[model samples]
Target: MLPKPIPPQPGQESVWDYPRPPRLERTAKRLRVVFAGTTIAETTQGWRVLETSHPPVYYFPPADILPDVLVATPRTSYCEWKGMAQYHSVRVGQRIAPDAAWSYPRPTPPFAPIAGYVAFYAAAMDACYVDDELVVPQPGGFYGGWITKDIVGPFKGVPGSWGW
Candidate 1:
């Protein structure tokens, strides 16, 4: 059975209210990812993907990321709504997080805005900030959503939520 939806507080958004197939929207909020005492990516022009039962996944423009941080991996995954995704490892100084980021190089038509954009897993980075607030990594290693104060969820990535 599907989990019951949580009612969002004022100023908060419930994941249940997000669309089923996911939607990409431009965001002006500051997004930053830090690792190994280095700022790997930062942007005010990121895009966010919102889907039912998940928190928003922010995708930063390639130009905003520091050069040489992302190294492509042989890993790949398929998303029903976004098409094939290519995995990337993040290396900052001597610290390396394998397959910690991903991008859809040739996304499905509806998700083309995210093409060549990179989304990092919050858990893999030392810190991820949305605006001025630190974000919580979405539950489960496989889903790369970032949870913030304004987002409410009985999220899909939690344990025993595989059927969701």
Candidate 2:
């Protein structure tokens, strides 16, 4: 059974109200990622994917990310809604976070706007922010959702949440 969703306060959103198929929407919120004392990415032109029981996953356009920081990896994963995803390791100076980011080179039609845009795992980074609010990584390492103050959930990725 699905867990009870937290009641959202004014100006907040509840993830349980999000749709099953996931919706990809453009966002002008300043998204930033920092690792190893370097600002690896910062973008106002980003997309966010929202699905039930999950926090939003922010995607940054390729131009906003530092090119040298991403090292392409052979890893790939299939998502039922987004299509195939390619992984990348994030490297800054001597630090490396393997498979810390992912992108879709060719997404399903509805998600085409995010093609080649990258999304980083907040858990793997020193910090990630939406506007000025620091992000909390989604509960599990498997999902790349960014949990900010304005979002509420009895989110997925927690133990006993798999069947949600």
Candidate 3:
């Protein structure tokens, strides 16, 4: 059963209001990711995927990420809407966050805008920021959505909300 969505207060957005098949949107907002005391990625050009019951998953362009920071892993996963996905481990200094990032190298047509763009798991990074606000990682390890003050939810990936 789907959980009732939390109503958004002024200036917030409800995840339930997002689309089912998800939509990729280009954003000019400043995006930042930090790990192991280093700012590993930062960009003003990024894409975000919004889906029903989930917060936005932001993707940064390849040019914004630091060189040699991403090491491809053998892991692969499939997204019904985005097609095959590949994983990457991010390393900075002595820290290694395994399978902490992913990309759709050859995305399905509808998601082609995000092809080769990398999305990181907020929980796996020391910090992630949308503009100046720090993000809260979406609940549950499997979903990489980043939650900021503007997004409201009884979001998916919570214990009983998986079936949503």
Candidate 4:
């Protein structure tokens, strides 16, 4: 499925565009991200990853994850579309991944659908796989744009992309 409100009247080539669907697209692309020390959070709503800028932050249902040991942090960030997002640190035995996980406690009007879903940074994760095959991490550090084999060279993850 897709999100609602539709996309800009069409024809507009803005970076912040979405193909809203009535329901969330529960793709077969579901994968697991294991951090060095993060625990997944199982919620009634589900696992939602809250991050912003350009791409729509990916949210995974709680039942879809195995959050055995992650620690919540006081860190937070604001997004124009979503709202305020909380942070978490995962601890697997002795190692710990700081702010490896994030969620939106209170989202704005448009993105209330993804209240508790969580998404882990592909770069911070030890490994992410869709069933059997491992997925490549999207190039940017701050942005989680996973790099797949099909993706050609030259990817940008900045605010004002100059020549990207």
- Report how far off residue 46 is in candidate 2 (Å): 0.3
Error of 1 at 43 (Å): 0.4
lDDT of 1 by residue, 48-91 (tens): 99999999999999999999999999999999999999999999
Q: Which stretches of candidate 1 lie over 4 Å from their true place?
A: none
Q: In candidate 2, what are the lDDT values of residues 117-146, reduced to their tens digit?
A: 999999999999999799999997899999
Backbone collision tally, model 3: 0
The digit string of per-residue lDDT tens for model 3 on 1-164 reads 77888999999999999998998899999999999989999999999999999999999999999999999999999999999999999998788999999999999999998899999999999999999899999999999999999999988888988789
Query: RMSD in angstroms, all models?
Result: 0.6, 0.6, 0.7, 7.9
Worst 10 residues of 2 by lDDT: 154-163
Cα shift from native, residue 47, model 4 (Å): 8.9
Give me candidate 3's TM-score against the actual structure.
Answer: 0.98
Q: What is the lDDT of candidate 3?
A: 0.95
Question: What lDDT would each prediction earn against the true structure?
Answer: 0.96, 0.96, 0.95, 0.53
lDDT measured at residue 97 in model 1 versus the true structure, 0 to 100: 99
Per-residue lDDT value at 3 in model 4: 21
Question: What is the Cα-based lDDT of residue 143 in candidate 3?
Answer: 96
Q: Rank the candidates by lDDT, best first.
A: 1, 2, 3, 4
In model 2, state the lDDT of residue 21.
99
TM-score of each: 0.99, 0.99, 0.98, 0.63
